[model samples]
Target: MKKRFLGYPNWWGEMPMAVYTFIEKHDWEGRTIVPFCTHEGSGLSGTERRIQSACTGAKVLKGLAVRGSAAQHEQESVRKSVSSWLEKLHL
Candidate 1:
């Protein structure tokens, strides 16, 4: 994957309004969406399902949830996990 990173600086139980708005306005039918998020504790907070529902016909792949703590202090570990996740996704 040439451009594969999606980072969320904060997680207050949902995606930023801009992201949802983008999803609402875009044509996602039959497209594939991969969700990745950084969280302190809540993990992905069901974003995969939310994206799938909002996108109608889109295929939502299994998401990656990297803890903000790990990303800040255990970056190498987070990198390995992210790499493994993308490999599994065939990206």
Candidate 2:
């Protein structure tokens, strides 16, 4: 598997406004927002909270915490979890 690391600019720290703007701009109300994260050790690491606070109108679901190193081997588990979430949300 090929791994790609996405590096954002320093302004990424100011991303909450961008996130809010995107949600409003896209008119994504009544949609479930699943915020998943890959971390070296921290797991979900408050990303879900951030999304919840930023996207006030959307339903922020519990996030999946995947270790970065294990992502390559966790495809099946990830697929199953995502499928289950989709079924539960009926989306």
Candidate 3:
């Protein structure tokens, strides 16, 4: 993985718009974007698709969505899950 990151401001039920705005404000051509998030219950919620559509020139990978509660109370499990996800992606 290269030393690059794209961080977007997100809110529940607002990820699609946020991603669109992010894409509009930035240039992600020829880059691989991995989206990850912590949500209460709406896991990913088609945000991956939105991201792909918004950033048409970038490759959007399958993302990991952690439940906010699980992340808060099951730190070790979250860590393991994230590690596994990254490993699967060969990152």
Angstrom error of the Cα, residue 84, model 2: value is 5.9
Per-model TM-score on C-alpha atoms: 0.83, 0.55, 0.82
User: Tens digit of lDDT per residue, candidate 1, span 10-55?
Assistant: 4766878787887788777667777888888888887777878888
Task: Give each model's whole-structure lDDT.
Answer: 0.78, 0.55, 0.75
What's the lDDT for residue 1 in model 3? 32
Over 19-91, each residue of candidate 2 has an lDDT whose tens digit, in order, gives 4566456533565676655556666656666666665566777656655556678888877876786577455
Q: Give the runs in model 3 whose Cα sits over 4 Å from its true position.
A: 1-13, 16-19
Which is superior by TM-score, 1 or 3?
1
| Candidate 1 CA-lDDT value | 0.78
What candidate 1 gets wrong by more than 4 Å, as runs, is 1-10
Best by lDDT: 1
